[model samples]
Target: MGLEVVPNTREVLIDLYTKTLKEIQVVPEDEGYKKAVESFTSHRPKLIEKKLGCGQVEELIEEAQDELTLIGKMIVIEEKKWLVDEDED
Candidate 1:
């Protein structure tokens, strides 16, 4: 018996990452907010590479990255929807 690897670690990280992204309320007009998002985006790849490991770690990283992009797009769409609602109200 050796060290036990936790199952679904990648999924857990993805959940947390997506939640964090979703909770961000920064608009595109703010340069500081853009830089903050950039910082998080820059670290995501390295964080996934370091924390999650399996036989096909590279493939896992790619999959995680794809999910991240989807999450980002979803956030943007939701924000736009909210802005429209606010304008209507």
Candidate 2:
């Protein structure tokens, strides 16, 4: 897995999610972002728990990458929805 961008200097995952939500126009609602966060939280540990009791940052990156894939798709859909709405006005 590749190294993911550092999620800001905050010590909490929720903080990271909150900050990320502010930076984007689409999927800013906690439900959407929270779903992504939940996806990462579940899958990340599954991969991590695979290794005795220790996991590497790379695993976290993998988990992040997976979550990003969903976010990107959702963002595209949201943007398209916004564009269509504007056209109808």
- Candidate 2, residue 69: Cα displacement in angstroms equals 1.8
Error of 1 at 73 (Å): 0.7
Judge candidate 1 at residue 17 and give its lDDT.
Answer: 58
Instruction: Report the C-alpha lDDT of model 2 over 17-83, residue by residue, as the tens digit.
Output: 4444443445655765766665545454454335523344544444445555666787788789899
Model 2, runs deviating above 4 Å: 1-26, 33-60
| Stretches of candidate 1 exceeding 4 Å from the true structure | 1-55
State residue 9's C-alpha deviation in candidate 2, in Å.
18
In terms of TM-score, the best-performing candidate is 2
* Backbone Cα, N, C clashes tallied per candidate: 0, 0
Q: Report how far residue 56 has shifted in candidate 2, in Å.
A: 9.1
Q: What is the lDDT of candidate 2?
A: 0.53
